[model samples]
Target: MANRHGPCMEKKCSWCCDPVKVPANFSDEKIPLDKEGKRIWRDREEIVVPESQMETVRLKTFDCDLLDTQTGKCSDYENRPEICRNTSCVDEKSTKSVDEQHRETLEEELIPLKGKK
Candidate 1:
């Protein structure tokens, strides 16, 4: 996962810790459930990538246990996983504002709608 977008330099950034897409074989039981016992992943299906090896799509995400919601920082920054060390929020999408992101998403959705007869 070469981050051509560069390293994550934003202060108080918890985007990486928010939701991680796991393998398709990952157990649903491991996913955290809300108080209503509903699956916690609100939008896991938004992004699905094809895994040729497994011949399936990987499209599930969950909050990392190490994330401190109040502070939006990792509990153990020094001992974070290698994946974390390699992650950065300098990408185009991560740099956009919430409203910009929403607009982009709506525009993306409308593309298919416009294509439809």
Candidate 2:
């Protein structure tokens, strides 16, 4: 890929690249962390959801193999899978955890697009 230059790339955001879905009860501290304190999700660890069968919602997750941990970017973006291409980095879900100031900035950036068909 010749650097598509999407917003995500410009900001170097890679939050969704590593999708970990633990049970709601699982504590954040329990997640393994790297030396830099970044969460290191277990490879294909099966979590048990409450009030459901043991394997009701088993999420087999691990960081993408192509991700460049140092740069927080995909090494092979041009060859990224369909699922990656379909994800939206600008969605509410993606920004919910961002700090208020950044969120406000994002909202301001989007103001012009509001009410557009």
The model with the greatest lDDT is: 1
lDDT of 1: 0.50
Which lDDT value does model 1 have at 55? 32
What are the C-alpha RMSDs, in order, of all predicted structures? 10.5, 14.5
Count steric clashes of candidate 1: 0
User: In candidate 2, what are the lDDT values of residues 41-113, reduced to their tens digit?
Assistant: 5444433232333334433345555678787787776666555665553445553543543444334321111
Give the CA lDDT, 0 to 100, for residue 86 in model 1: 57
Q: How does model 2 fare in lDDT?
A: 0.48
Quote each prediction's TM-score.
0.40, 0.41
lDDT score at residue 106, model 2, on the 0-100 scale: 37
Candidate 1 error regions (>4 Å): 1-9, 22-58, 91-117
Tell me how many clashing residue pairs each candidate has.
Answer: 0, 0
